[model samples]
Target: MGKITTHVLDTMAGKPAAGVRVRLFRGAELLNETVTNSDGRCDSPLIENPSAGCYEIVFSIGEFYHIHGTESPFLGEVPIRFSVEVGQHYHVPLLCTPWSYSTYRGS
Candidate 1:
């Protein structure tokens, strides 16, 4: 079965970005809302039995930075949009900091 997963890493701190909020959306409809665990991974799969379509995941960056003690974070909501195909597992990993972020498709 196809699935979608994600994790956030704090590049500046060199650790998993725990407590960050993540939201998944299919088009304009919200799918799920989850927070990162101590490992920076959602407690459950964001999308299970996934189908092919366009989807986006929004990361709550500003709040995370604020709680982590960044007075002024450069980014707020970070959204990553991509398409899913049949029979594939999509692992979208984010490496971020108060100033910058990056993502990539992982196995």
Candidate 2:
């Protein structure tokens, strides 16, 4: 079965980015949204049986940093755009700081 999941780790705190709001979208269409758990993972898979198309992950970075009491200029949203092939499991993990972030295909 095709599936997609993600994790977020706060490098500044050396822990998971718990309680961070995450929104998934397929182009202009909103698919689903949820908050990350203590392990920085969504409680459920973000997508399953996803068609071959473009998907974007919106992470509420500014708010997350605020909650963590990190100094920030509120640089706006963090969005990661990726494409999924048919019938595959996609794991995207984000390692973020208050000012910047990075993501890649994860196991």
Count clashing residue pairs in model 2.
0
User: Over the stretch 1-107, how does candidate 2's per-residue lDDT look in tens digits?
Assistant: 88889999988788998988999999999899999999999999998889998999999988888876866735457899999999999998989888778889988
Worst 10 residues of 1 by lDDT: 43-52
| Highest lDDT against the true fold, candidate | 1
Per-residue lDDT of model 1, residues 22-79, tens digit only = 9999999999999999999998889887789999999999899999899999999999
RMSD of each: 0.6, 1.2
The number of clashing residue pairs in each candidate reads: 0, 0
The residue-level lDDT of candidate 1 at 73 comes to 98
> In model 2, how large is the Cα lDDT of residue 75?
41
Give lDDT per model, in order.
0.95, 0.89
Q: TM-score per candidate, in order?
A: 0.98, 0.94
